[model samples]
Target: MPDRLAPLTEALLAAAQKAGAEAADAMAADGRAVSVDVRGGALEQAERAEGTEIGLRVLIGRRQACVSASDTSARTIAEMAERAVAMAREAPEDPTVGLADPAEVARIWNLSALDLADPAAEPGAAALEDDARRAEAAALAVRGISQCQAASASYSRQRIFLAASNGFAGGYTRTSRSTSAVAIAGEGLGMERDWAAESRTYQSDLPSPEEIGALAGRRAAERLGARKPKTGAWPVVYDERIASGLIGHLLAAINGASVVRGSSWLRDAMGAQVLPKGLSIFENPHRPRISSSRPFDAEGLATAPRDIVRDGVLKSWTLDLGTARKLGLRSTASATRGPSSPPSPSISNIALTQGDRSREQLLETMGTGLLVTAMIGSSVNPTTGDYSRGASGFWVENGQIAHPVNECTLAGNLRDMLMRITPANDARAHLSHVVPSLLVEGLTLAGE
Candidate 1:
């Protein structure tokens, strides 16, 4: 591969400076990906894509504008810079928008320690097709599995570079591989579907196709005879597969962008108890071999581990430079951005404290409740924390699974839900959000 991105970003920065911008930043990304899908034990689709893109953000006084293009020619770069500068000149001034101070930029990073990219050669298209076909065949082999809806295998690699006029430049490469299978059980109106997937930064770390297919088949078979549970307020146990979404709600509420806009339910939750005592949410951006792990943020700021929630108390807000300044706080180095957008607050690798008990133990302790394994549409009131969603899962009675249930509405206020959650020790360690199965007490379920 050509070392073309570094010079491209540098060129964008130089163009922006020549266009008479007060400050500027530039980003470049080169990526390639291949994907294969199989169904009915045959290749359904195969795709390969490769592209390079560059973006320029120029600041005129306190106003800024971002523009991106796939073309890297010098003429195009100059035009992009000129357009961005013109747009910035006409845009309303936002005093908080500008490049990070030179001292605040990440001065050093260790990409090797992070192990973000795999060193192995890319898998051939035929190999990907074989993986997908195997997964589909395995699912079809399972008893009670009516069909393999879809099976897929994919691999991607991307290199990103960032350069700013304030003397900051950094770049990194990342790779990912994933396999998934979706299976259907029963026939006609009784058919139910479920899926299983595994993704890793390296191909060697991905779960086997057989394992993924078997899990998908089993999950679908388990839902073969799903019915609605009796309507009432019940304790709800979110299965490990879906439990991360509950924590995701909390994360969104504490996002600096939401907080600044007064749109988050957790706007006033700093230093307050948002989770059960002894539970904490930790962010570690430098975790090795994790897809979300990063040595530095999009704005070239150094990232480090921090406790977003400590012992149930709301501790910090996810922040980028702009949102931090808007709130009169220091940047948390949580900035994330794409080629066509400016940096914004976002989280990387995070893990919630796990409870001592296993998921089975938690189920036994609950005695009678709904064990939600999947959810559909959502209606969440961001400002008030009101939450309601369509859910489907197994119902627990007398400490055992009685039957699968579906078409139920789970309703509760998120502000109150997190306070009463009991985590089960079932989190997948390699996930970006390592939240375990969670049991929240007293949620209303609208069912039969």
Candidate 2:
């Protein structure tokens, strides 16, 4: 709970100051999780984990060092602070390594309106086991499903407190509940597998286990008897379930860290068109009850809505305090970090502009191509924007799904591919990344 975590962070900051650090930040996280997994109508594994972790980042002049430990005792906290200060003394100096300015820290936030933590009682182990068992049973009930490989239910709650020498101090609590199932449709060498999962901040908002399992079963059944498609340059439709990854690549490309290192393909693309005209990408960190919503970033900076891409033009790079300073730009308040790690720029929630057409309409527009429901591996060149990935899904012919496909590689230049994509309006509104199914033209497919 924040009540307990706050004192630990206060103790850490006090210890850091006593250890001769010029400035410092402390984070204390307390969390517990319970998970149950079922297979073959029986309980296969059950786990419960609970722990508290504390981290310290100390700055001596322009140098900094980070240390973390599971131990939260006074002696351990003091030792961590001393160790961090000593490490900072020997580390290379970086001008951007100090804490946020006191005036820049978030001072006013509304936690209740965000609705981050669910007030419901934690689910018991028996309840989780029952959910997993029911999901497995539902998957096995489907006619074509040869097996329910795994079904699981889980719940977790975490509270975090952050304090810094710059007078920034705040904490928040979060909870998550989830159910999932993986199904296999055929036997031995002919098997094809798929999965379905749903997670929500509130237990009541989570979908039923039977629904999750049945969806997994149907997805796997649809992949039976898959074969390679004819190799050629063809259109490709990235299904809504996985289309966010396509946009994720662009997000990575525009990350301030990558731009600073000159290693990103989009390093030279600021203010230039990245997507097709009329398309845009927006980021908002305050969406109520969403998993990624946060009132303040890791550096204690307020987070707000901003456009990363506007009308197809690259508008802003995702930035944290350090990256923003390095680029001589304002911070975007996108910092994210965990115990034992330093803060880095990370997007919260993003939505690519949706189109007016449906996914089926996009498929019809494509006429014939690969409808990628799943992808594996990656060979994306961050510097060159060349992209390739192993894919499997249905093969479409004459604007309709013809048969299942497998063991194929899709290749394209991300810069070119993004510019050519046509989005469909079926993006799940609940997700952090609300990207729609995307239709891209003339990609090289390596298959039969």
Candidate 3:
């Protein structure tokens, strides 16, 4: 695939140079995916997709323009380069727009150590359908599950190569396999739904369809007869499945783009305390087999581990070359981009520090409160850090789950909430965002 993609990128760069661009970078991607969906013990949908896409970004001084095409013909490549160069000629100039210096580009990376691609043959459509059907059957096998809403299995493989006139060229391939199921507990007005899903870089590591479906069934069965909790200022525990979102809000607050726009609550908080004294958030880009791990960033710079928050103090802002240049800081090599756009700062794999206690222990510590497992619509003030979201889960009383809950609102300021959180040691290690269940104290809950 590298051999196949290298030529397309080379052609794009050549065309860009011929089209009178001062500098250029080119990206080429080839991907194939297959998915199967099952409903009511029958095949509902089967889809297979395969494509090659190419993009060229031409720079004329500080002005740049990007053009992309699914068609990889010579004429199409030439036309894309010419159009991009022409567009750059009229685009607004930004001093931060440019490629990495040759000395700063990643010259060597260990793709073999990354182990991104699986060696197994792609699963056939029949096999995928069988997996989905088995999942659906397993879900329906649960005693209280009224229906299996949907079950699905899918696989995808993608290879991408990046090249630039600044003497950088590299590429890598990645693969993913997944199975999932959704189950309903009751009929009509009393119905409730829940889901289970797992994905892995290697197909062999994925859980069996029956296991996933059974978990989904059990989850939905547990939600039967859910009602609103009593309204009050109470403690709330975000379950591990949804806890990453709480940390994600902090990540967004510290994003370089948001900071540059003066829209982030954390813009004035660098080097200040943002979390509890013992907590930290670390970003690592080289963890093997993790889907978000990358050897090099979109700007062809080497990626490495760094701390976003250290001992509760804000340590670093996620930055790309452009953002780093604008802020007078070195690049963190956090740039991410698709074939259709320029690079932007985006964190890859992050892990919030885990705690000594289990989720049940944390619940016991909180006594009576909402154990939030799911959330709906969001109303967050990025500038003020005010947060509110609709939630549903179980209500805890005397350190144990009392009953299912639904249609409640949790409101608080993120700045205060993060400082007061107590983390549980229940984060799934395989996920890109490894945040544990978090218990926040004294939040306003609106319910019946």
- Candidate 1 residue runs with Cα over 4 Å from true position: none
Report the candidate with higher lDDT, 2 versus 3: 3
Give every collision pair in model 2.
none
Quality of model 1 by C-alpha lDDT: 0.94
- Candidate 1: Cα lDDT at 441: 96
For 310-362, candidate 3 gives per-residue lDDT tens digits of 99999999999898988999899999888889999999999999999999999
- Residue-by-residue lDDT tens digits, candidate 1, 260-350: 9999999998999999899999999999999999988988899999999999999999999999999999999999998889999999999
Per-candidate TM-scores read 0.99, 0.99, 0.99
Q: By lDDT, is 1 or 3 better?
A: 3
Worst 10 residues of 3 by lDDT: 1-10
Candidate 3: segments with Cα more than 4 A from true spot: none
TM-score of 2: 0.99
Residue 102 lDDT in candidate 1: 95
Best by lDDT: 3
